[model samples]
Target chain A: MTRLNTLLLLALAVTVPLSLLAGRVWIDPFDPALPNAAVIFAELRLPRAVLALLLGAGLGAAGATMQGYLRNPLADPGLFGIAPGAALGAVLSFWTGWAASGWALPLFALIGAAGAMALLGAIAGRGGGVLLFTLAGMMIASLAGALMSLAISLSPTPFAMSEIVTWLMGALVDRGWADVWIAAPLTLLGLAVLLRAGRSLDALTLGEVAARSLGIDPRRLQLLMIAGVGLTVGAGVAVAGIIGFVGLMVPHFVRPFTDRRPSSLIVPSALAGALLLLVADCLCRVLPLAGGELRLGIALSLLGAPFFLHLLLRLRRELA
Target chain B: MIKQSNPTPSVRVERSRETGARRVSTTLDTNGGLECAGVVLKARLADVTASLKPGEVTAICGPNGAGKSSLLAVLAGLLASDSGAVSLDGQPLNQLPAPKRAQAIGFLPQSAEVAWDISVETLAALGRLPWRTSAAEDAAAVQGALAALQLESLRDRPVSQLSGGERARALLARVLAGEPRWLLADEPLANLDLAHQLALLARLRELARRRGLGVVLVLHDLAQAMNHADRVLVLDLGAVVADGPPEMVLTADLISVVWGVPARWLGEPGARALLPG
Candidate 1:
């Protein structure tokens, strides 16, 4: 185990309890029997904290798998268009007046994500060319993005638009154990698939022909990636709306811990992602923002965009 | 340093003659030769036939589009031919599972596109994917390959950061670490320097002579092919123009016919040969 991976895991463990402590009401960890302190800690903090940790790990793993399978270092979970598809589904849940049905939005989002994944597989061909796959993902994202915009534009009520906007920005407020149950199993399954498919990713470093010659079927590798990303990112976006940058940035941060072996980077990236999102969620609770509470996704985007810009600059310089 | 100069050809192939000592239940290694009979790749092969005997180094040399690489790819199962069959020890090549086939044949493509900065040790260890060897066994094989290729000093460095010649040796070490029965490399000597190229050829020749590993390589240098390989298979426009000993196969007339250049072969027997046009 590298020092960075060890630190990331240590950070994950420490950040979990810290996230539980960062709500509007300062619930003391030492005191158990205060007025509604246990209620606030149990009913509110625990689920949100656990959900953030797991979803962040899923996104991180997804990012590592995408960059590896596509053979591009800058790749992320959202590159597959699953995130946008999930957003579109969640938006439809609002427009169709099904948002009131506890499970409709996330369920709709999962279906949309799965559909987009299938479309990507069909368009990219069974051979799994990086350019073709990226183009297919872009097309899927564009279609999903267009549909989301159409839904927002065609809304009959302004209140619905506002509600939709708030949901789309993403929040961890008032989430319960039920939300955790919805996303946990799927994310775990996805993470397992991605983690176990390391051999193919490692073989892929030698390029398609060499990887194939090494007994790795490119189609099988792509299928495993598609299924893995679909379940985790789909369930994640369905629950938390569009949490951007966790997938893209965590891999780069954890990459140094690994010897550039894509397989070994999975766990470290997962741990770092959990740490990042937990920190972000904690920041959302304590930061003195004017608008009651800050959105978790907005906080991630704020941290991610500049990091992304920096990476772009580095890439440009490397190319130059 | 250099394993040795041109080794005396010994017919002791790597396979153990003690039949009961075999570990695996598969018939993967029961037969000896890697044979391609009437193999027809759509645009690449038109019922081509060739065979590689155990513990013998064979070189296939030809022009750019002479299907040297395609032939190698077909042999390595990297390309599927429309017709004909490839058999290993008499069993069909495609019938065997990927791991079994990989166990029998190690392939080195012309260029392996590396996307990350991985250490040489990690790069070499990837060859053990086909077999689940014990940790000690894996370590020994990786170390042995590195030592054999004289890459132990560079083992800790990132393969992506190595010089072209160094990277080529590292990649070769990766394939050798697997200990496959046959090695099929496509123009592996192209990026290597003159000394390394000769050293590599020497090493391959020794591997065939001592370990009984069938070493097949694609080469552009006719003199090098004639000097190092026991036999030469010359391809021209996807057809085998010549197949025999170096003396019988690489004549001046054959060079003109295949490579489209008139060249004179100048050298004595059992000595370095040079092709000057």
Candidate 2:
């Protein structure tokens, strides 16, 4: 591991313990008089923190791979439409009262994600270039977003409509070990797939022709990107709603510290992403809000928009 | 325009003899070179056939839209022809595994761009992607490539910070680090200065003569081709108009008919210049 990776790993170690101890009802690990403290540690905080790490790592690694594959710094896995497709499936579950069952909701979301991946692959065609793949993803995202809106508007009950809207805002509140069980394996598998694509992504930095000459199979690369992004973003939405900015923001924070090769950036980005999410979730728990904790998705978006503007301004200055 | 003082051919023959012995001692196979048997690429190339040999520098010269770049791409195995096949040593090029083909042939595209702000040394080391050998071997190859391109001083600088000529040299150095049996480049001198162009031409000739490497360059300058190349292949429209030694193939009448410029050669053989009528 590089120095940057080692540093990020150490930071993650520190943040994990802090995340468990900093909730609304703070638990002092050294104190013995508190009631149900062990239950809170085991039942509530542990699963949430683990879920945050898994989902955040998936998104961060996916972001770095996408940027490298597209050769565009602004690329994020959310652009692939898998997240919105999963959200649409979850929204449909709520609208039909099927979400009352535990497994049906997540199962439906996974099916939705699989459908989007299939659609994207079909539309991009065999051996299609990155430009075609990107345009296809944009089309799928718009279609899924429109369908979700249609489902929300046609809800039979106002309570169902409210539930769909709040879930779309994205949070990890009241999530149990079941959510962790669903996300953990899929996220790890997705990270493995993304890592496999890293060296090929580095080859693509020299343009399509040069990459091909360097023995990179474009078709294989496209398949890996689709599979990796679909699994990570889809599973994340199935459990935690639409956590957006962790993917886009985490890579930028970790890039300057590394050698800037896509392969070298992935592991570090994943670690930094886990740390950022754990810290942010801890803050959400500790802050006093009359209407409950701030939604993780909403809070990230609030921070993300300003950071995006700052990036654009800096890029423009560099160009000038 | 031939110069009596120039002993380029004799000097090249002596170097080839020395490298020929070296090639036999090593495992280098020189019996079968890259060959395209009657390749046709849908209005871009028509029945183009050429057998390129090692220890020679061949220049492909043509006007714009004359299929120079397409031919180079086909030869580099980056493009598939509409009909016919390209073979290396009697084995079909398409049948060879991608990594194996990459190990044997290095290609530099006309407008290759770096997507990230990596250092020059890092960019050169990317050539070892197909090898993935030991750390010491990879570092030595990268160091040699940087020295060949006169980029050793700028090895630590980011590619984005280099001048246009320096960047061109850096990209070519990447192909050099691969240490392939053949090197194919398309319009590599487009952005280079005169001094850099001459230096690069000399380097290619040296690699071909001393290392027994086959070099195919797509050059726009007739003077460079006439002065530096051991053999010249001229394309008019989409067909091979002429193929032979530079002096015999690049005549004034052929230039008038093919380039429609009515140009004539001036200066000595080793330092030739073209003047338009």
Candidate 3:
């Protein structure tokens, strides 16, 4: 099963790049065709596709890491406050006009994610279980959502509101290579940290006491996992805005394929995530909705939400 | 019955250097074994002091509120005590890192809850975490443990699909794969049937004798404890009331005092006392 999953991931990694190359074309064909095509392919489509892949992989891998670290199957960065915290930070930066420069938004987003995770650690420390953590995450997410709404409502210009709305809806449109470069390194670094913590994650499956008996410090592992997820999800959201369901769905879809071992699940989840995002982006490009400029987030949620619900129901039945 | 001779096979025991009052600890010769002295464990509630020797199945029999599990936890280094210390072969257990401690001790908690769905072999390999050895070595150890526990056919099956007894045996395989010196089991026979209960006790005793491993089990069943344990410690509330051979510790008065149940002991010499209804 693991072998088959690895093969599928390898195939997707190759195909995604080829698809990005084939799909990129100049919108304005009549004005100096060859150079325009080259510029469009190099500048816009290539970077956007790369960003999609990176962000997708980051969120998916982070989600899997968080789930394993927490020993909770339902955990994901999007549902568990990391994405919303990052969104809040970016929006706050944008509202303050501090992130007018290139990298400020992502930097602040990472800080916000770190802050949220720290808060989660504190809350979870006080005799709280996964349900409590989930509630706390939901509360933080809702609070962030309200703050974002207030920021949009109070903005002096319609242009700022429009930008915020587009971000909230999520889009890979008009992203440059510079944005991709900014987010990619941070996300990759987070993935590396998570992979290193894989063995600790396996120990954690047997509960905190057993893990400790096996010589894993559960508290330290938890903190490291939170940091890793924080960095990746923060950078991901800052780069691509709020792309939901990829983190939540990809891990579940890829878990059985990896024999449900956290050590083997990380890379597969990342690959599946990248593929899911790339395919969603491709559909966004070709779909007739909104005159072929549909938001990738919308396309993703449309496909993912029902599947997520179905999974929840199935889990509920199994537990019952 | 495979020549049930003296369980403690005398081998070359390496003795650790002692300072003044503390005695030198003995190491297992080829076979796995453990030796502890002046082991004091303190928790929020109480303190416990005891010593465990190799090649004996010792049952820490106690009431519900007794510090049996806590003692096990301290010995396993899952919980750090306040003052008194534990040492394996005169080496301080506290000085060793978590991984090294794991290499020397195999702990089976009363209940092990796992969320991930994985095959039995994969689960058993988790025991090799402490060894930090190669995957091939881990695989071999897991296979040996599985065969020892009669779980060869269930190696590829998911742990979630196994019955409770099967799961317990699979988990036992995971712990045994570590090849630790001391086996610390908390209520290992809690949910097993009569046959499985006897089987588990027999297996533990066999391991302690054949491998020279030190076995310390926290047990609630007086009959099982009396039957299988070479030595027994009876605890009530938070203190040890009696400690010695099973015949001496499993008395009617001790059972009545510790368990608050009307019971009697009936046995001949070199036989286990039966508790009748």
Candidate 4:
């Protein structure tokens, strides 16, 4: 591991524990006859923190894979409409009051994401050009957004409509072990597949003919990477709704520290992704508010968008 | 255009600028070659049959769109032949596993487009990817290739920061790090200055002779091909129009027929040189 990797890993280890700590419902490290407190910590705070870490890592890795595979800095798995599709699925569950049903929302969300990708492929035809890519993404996001609104409008009352709308903005509040179980396996599998794309992607930078000559079959690699991105982003949106910029920004930040080799960046990007989200979630926990914690995605965007602008200005100044 | 009625083996080394400094020749052993039989590839590549032998550099020269790149792609197993067979050694090329094929054959396309602005060391190390799952051998291999291409000083420099010729050499070092038995390059001399082009060709020739490596290069510059290649394979309209020792194969008539410019040859005694009129 490089010095940066070691530092990132250390940061991640500290972040996760810090994330689990400082919640409103606090449990003493050791107290007689406080077994119920321990159960609450295990069943509630720990699962939420773990879910946030996994979701962040998944989105980050998937984003990195999409960017690397397409050779585009702006290609976000969420922007590709998978996250909107997932949000739509979760909205449908909420419309039908399926939020109370364990894991049903995530399950429906995964299907929605997969279906959106399939639909995107059918509409755009194997991602031919940058225009088609953006067009397909817009179409899927619009359709999913429209459908989510439709689901809310069809709800029994204004309360249900508001519930689905808030959920759509993205959150990790009230999550449990069920959310963790639902997302973990698929996210890890997706990450593994994406990481495997490092070598093929490196070959691809040499161009199509060269990559093929280097013994990397681009067709096979593309199929595997796209599927991996879909699964990862799908699982993340299923649990955390639609956290933006973590995917798009984390890789950009981590890339400079890495060798800039697509594959080598995956692990570090994932770690940073996990840490970034942990900080955001932990901030949500630690901040005192009369109306409980702020929504996770809002906090992320609030922090991330400003940082993004700062980076852009710095980049421009450097270029200038 | 140079026409040689009789050519000598020692003339190959005598022609190069680095005549003596860059050689530790092996016994000139020759085997493990690629053979294409009646192969028809993408629309660009038609029925082409040729043999590339180890321990010698063969230049595939032709006018633009003469299937030079397509032929090399087919040989590298990047493209499947529509008809006929290409065998590495004796086994069918497609049947070879990708990792094994990568180890045996190194291919460099004309474009040196690396998406990331990575270090030269990291970029060169990519050529050793097939063998990377093993121990720390990749570092040594990367170093050896960088040194071989005379890019040791630029190893830590970012590829984006390197000059045009330096970037070209870095990409070449990537291919060399693979330690392939057969190295196929498409129009590698493009964008290089005269000095670097000649130096690269000389280095390739030395590697072929010393490492028992087979090299097939698609060259637009007929003059460079005629001077460097042991054998010249000329393609016209997707077929091998001429194939033999460079001295025997290259002539004003063939050059005029393929390139469509009337030319005459003036040869020197030191080495068979081409001077077009």
True contacts kept of each: 0.72, 0.72, 0.79, 0.74
Candidate 1's error at B201, in angstroms? 1.2
Model 3, B139-163: lDDT tens digits are: 8899899999999999899988999
lDDT of 4 by residue, A1-320 (tens): 88887998888887777666557765655553555676767887899889878988888888787777777666677767888888888888887787777778888898898888787666555433334655677788998989887787789889888877787768888888888888899899999888888888887766666676677766567556657877888888898788888888888988988888878778888888888888788788878988878898888889778977887797688579
Instruction: For residues B1-277, write the lDDT of model 2, one tens digit per residue.
Output: 2222123321111101111111111122335989886677776877677778877888999889888999999999999987767888767889999989999999999985999998899899888888879999999999999998889999999998999888998999999998889999998889889998998899998898889888999999999999998888888666777777788778898888788898888898878899999
Model 1 local distance difference test score: 0.83
For candidate 4, write residues B1-277 as lDDT tens digits. 2322124422211111212222222221124478887776545656677777887888998888778888998898877767767788877888999888999999998888987889999888888866655647877888899999889988889987999999999999999988899999988999999999989999998898889888899998877877788888888767777777766667777777678777755565324556666
Sorted into a CAPRI-style docking class, model 2 comes out as medium
Q: lDDT of model 3 at residue B52?
A: 72
Model 1 ranges off by over 4 Å? A1-5, A31-34, B1-31, B270-277
| lDDT (Cα, tens digit) per residue for candidate 1, span A61-167 | 99988888888888888888989998998898899889889988888888888889888888868666667788889889989999999999998689889989999
List runs of model 4 lying over 4 Å from the truth: A24-40, A96-100, A117-157, A288-292, A309-320, B1-32, B267-277
What TM-score would every model get versus the actual structure? 0.92, 0.94, 0.88, 0.86
Q: How well is each residue in B1-277 modelled by candidate 1, as lDDT tens digits?
A: 2122124322211211222212222223335588787666655655567777888888998888878999999888777776777788888888988888887899999986677888998898888878788999999999988998899999999976899888988898888888899999999898778988988899898888889999889999878888888888777667666676777677777777667687886668546566567
In model 2, where do residues sit more than 4 Å from their true spots? B1-31
Q: Name the runs in model 3 displaced over 4 angstroms.
A: A21-35, A99-101, A118-143, A157-159, B1-45, B267-277
DockQ comparisons of all candidates to the true complex: 0.58, 0.64, 0.64, 0.53
Candidate 3 C-alpha lDDT tens digits along A1-320: 56856686777868666655544352443455465676766787788888888988888888788788677777777666877888888887777777778787777777777778877778667333445666777787788778878988987678777777777777788889878877888889888887888988888788767778888876667666666787788788877788887888889887876778788888888888888888788777766665658887887888878987898899899989
